[model samples]
Target: MIKHDVSHFPTILVFNTTEKDKTSVALIKNGSVKISEKSRRAQELQSIVEELIDNNHIEIGEIKAVAVLEGPGSYTGIRIGATTGNTLHWLYRMPVIVIPGTDISEAAERLMSGEEFDVTTYFSPRD
Candidate 1:
């Protein structure tokens, strides 16, 4: 249970399952990342959600929106994360925003440099 003060911002839940090393679920508030959990197994999805819920990191009703990584990579991983996000959005009547995995890198680059940058990123299949 990791706790941080994010009371001034809208809570956004983000799930990324595009690549193994980069797979993660994060909570963002006021333009800063708050809580983040990363894992490789698809099975860890439930635990990740439970961890967020159990810790009171995000209140169900207070979730402003949900963001999911819509991928051109792991089909199963993307589906798992999307399903979770969709279910939550439907259950709580929150808006769901789908962001492609590639865009996330681009966004990070823009944020850091304050300028647009071009970069290539992808996920390779497991043996």
Candidate 2:
């Protein structure tokens, strides 16, 4: 298990794609939203996140965890967000926390408590 002490590393990369037409990416620090960007271009999600990180001068490693807002919104958007979060988890070995709603504080609490969720298991498209 990874140590997710927010005080040690307060930066958390958040992805909120629960909206029908737009995707939101944010840098969260110390339980507060630091910087954020929204895009209607769902296909540009990856680039948007990259640019946001770059613009904020936040390194990938500096992010304590990846918090993804899972569903109750756009299907495709949710898929994209989860996939990106999972990819980041795999590539960088960062912990991925799935937020069922838009609550960032709740996710932070879960992280602090060391409650782990399988990021990949949350998204399964209904056929």
Candidate 3:
């Protein structure tokens, strides 16, 4: 439901560990992507992120943006995940986008079922 220019950033880092019960981490670049949702997100978040990028052979500098599934979940987890994206933005000088989590699940489900998914714009705090 938030809007901003996403064209400036091609590669995106997605964070979805807002829910304590269900969590995931994803890294996306062009047509290559990796995602994991095997639980213990707190312990696996960092490593998954590293491995996702590493396995994909994407350099850290190539990540042009970050997207976070924000809210409607564990408060502490959301803050921690969002904070990580914020830190990335601060270090990389790219945009950090915060999106509503409620719809993200539905979108993901649809995608898994080979259904159409609407491409929505993202919102950045710096804007």
Q: Per-residue lDDT for 11-119 in model 2, tens only?
A: 7787877776676777776655644556475667888788888887768888867878776777887788878877887788776766667544555555455455544
Residue-level lDDT tens digits of model 3 in 79-98: 76767777777777767666
Find the number of clashing residue pairs for candidate 3.
Answer: 0
List the global CA lDDT of all models.
0.56, 0.66, 0.62
Candidate number with greatest TM-score:
3
Off by over 4 Å in 3: 102-127
Q: After superposition, how far is residue 6 of candidate 3 from its true place, in Å?
A: 1.8
The lDDT leader among the candidates is 2
TM-score result, candidate 2: 0.71
What TM-score does each of the candidates earn?
0.64, 0.71, 0.72
Please, what are the lDDT tens digits per residue for candidate 1 over residues 15-93?
A: 7776655566666555666444565565587677567656765566777666666667777777776777777766776
| RMSD value for candidate 3 | 5.4
Tell me which residue pairs clash in candidate 2: none
Clashes (N, CA, C under 3 Å) per candidate: 0, 0, 0
lDDT of 3 at 32: 45
